[model samples]
Target chain A: MMVPVRCFTCGNVVGEHWEEFDERSNEGDEDPEAVLDELGVDRYCCRRMLVSHTDLVDVVSPYQ
Target chain B: MSEEYDVEFVEREDREARFLVRGVTPAFANGIRRAMVADVPTMAIDTVRFIENSSVMFDEQIALRLGLVPLTTPPEGEFVEDDTVTLSIDVEGPDTAYSGDLVSNDELVQPADENVPIIDLKDGQRLEAEADAVIERGKNHAKHQGGVGVGYRHLQRVEVVDDLPEFEEQESQIVRGVIEEDGELVSTTEFDHDLSKRYPGKEVRLEDVPNAFVFHVETDGSFTIEELVTRAADTIEARATELEDAVQL
Candidate 1:
């Protein structure tokens, strides 16, 4: 199903990458909270961190 | 301009006609960008001589849930004051239908036998009971899959229950209203998608309705019987004024 996700600040479309990455990395004991902490997003974020891996990867480009 | 009021329109989810209006006050930009929401006769929009004084702004949920009006201008073009508050009236009419008076305490009790007398209660009892019911409901609804806290959902609306099999024998028109801690009246308008046909301009959310919560009549509302009686009397006075104006000498 298409994921429902939007930027918290401006309500813009980020991507399905975060949600995909979350489901894949949710192995072991790592929850969304831990993932968000590792990614350094302040605050609790939303109840469900609705983003895909592609969205998070774009924050830092390849050449950077 | 002391008469110019900045207006802002805020739209929200699942509802229309309700909007937000923020105002400003005279305290910045050398009084150039100053707005007040004081009571003023708004005949025409003229700068320098006419500006809104005293304004009130509410959050989106509050505005939609309360069904406020959609203002076109931002009330913040001028510096806003602290005490400035707006009535947030949207529907066009003289009687600002405060969501509070929607479900008054004095229900039109079907006249029983002459021996049975009317019942009345002390003040504040109804408000307290209604608040308690709302709190209890908030707690129950909070137990969702995500464990959301007691948020805006806590403020429910008043409802109008249609004919049910149980109440078929004794029919009475029931109008409900929800009360929030911040003093917002919640109820459905006649503007909801399907419910708009019968109630063309009123809509109250399902959970926010105070009907099921009204277990007792003597004390489970926002106002006392005496206050409602006063309102009824006022309606009569208004009707009298209308008759006097229409009668030919």
Candidate 2:
């Protein structure tokens, strides 16, 4: 997964929430904003880190 | 006799807090800030050994991710520097790996926030690793930093001159202060640095109190902000006492 360790702007640790956020958003049970709010992520910088991540591990791992 | 110093709470919350300190020297104020940013110690993953890997995330990447996870710092006197806390992760593919998966050998030093995502595995992928946690100061690295946003500002007093032109049209664009009765601009009760930038040439003047400071602290869940501040104060006191003892010696 292409999870960032920290928010670029605020430097708050954010990579930990990517899995649950992805699962809930994909299941259509909740939107990204609601999921982030529930997770106690209140900053826009940290929120953007989750909403913009893409899992490129599958493609990159094959070359390794 | 030492001058009396007063601490007033401006705001308080679980992860963040702000307070005002009055009748203190600038050196003392900055000492607290330095102690908070560099002296206070926290638990962080210092080393990682991969046992198995079939996932796409590289070993180094996985290690880096694990190292950044904030581990709970035990209460005062409970932390031993260089002591090892082990964490192991074992997971199969077709799912996601999280900080919750990394179980700690010591219950007191587990991940502060459990829901952090470490990696995502496809149907056939798997990852296993063992991580060692160590107590370190923020001076050694940011990962060991107890507080994320530890800073302070001089308390400000703002006054608006009424002789200036009233730019009612630009009122909405003001970054700080609010329009009040008689079309006068009044500084907001909150201390904000952007007050002067609200209007380019407006008659708002701000004066900073030399001996009064407003401190703002935000923690990363490894420890309470209050605990961090208290510990920082203790660290400063210890250092000062050491200096005095050396002078006597």
DockQ of each: 0.01, 0.46
* Model 2 ranges off by over 4 Å: A8-10, A17-52, A61-64, B160-204
- lDDT for B36 in candidate 1 is 10
- At residue B204, what lDDT does model 2 achieve? 70
Give the range where candidate 1 chain B is weakest over 10 consecutive residues by summed lDDT: B127-136
lDDT string, candidate 1, A1-64, tens digits: 2222323332212222344345545544567656665643323343244533223212332322
Task: Compose the digit string of candidate 2's lDDT tens values, residues B1-249.
Answer: 198998877778987887788898888898999898888989999899988987777799888888888888998888679788899999898887888888888879888877777887887788998989999988898888887767787776656765346654323222332223242323354325254455445567556766877788888888887899999998888888999999994
At residue B199, give the lDDT of candidate 1: 37
Q: For model 1, how does the per-residue alpha-carbon lDDT over B56-160 read when each residue is reduced to its tens digit?
A: 211222222222111111122221222222222222222222233222122221111111101111221111101001111111221100111101112243355
lDDT of 1 at B131: 9
User: DockQ for model 1?
Assistant: 0.01
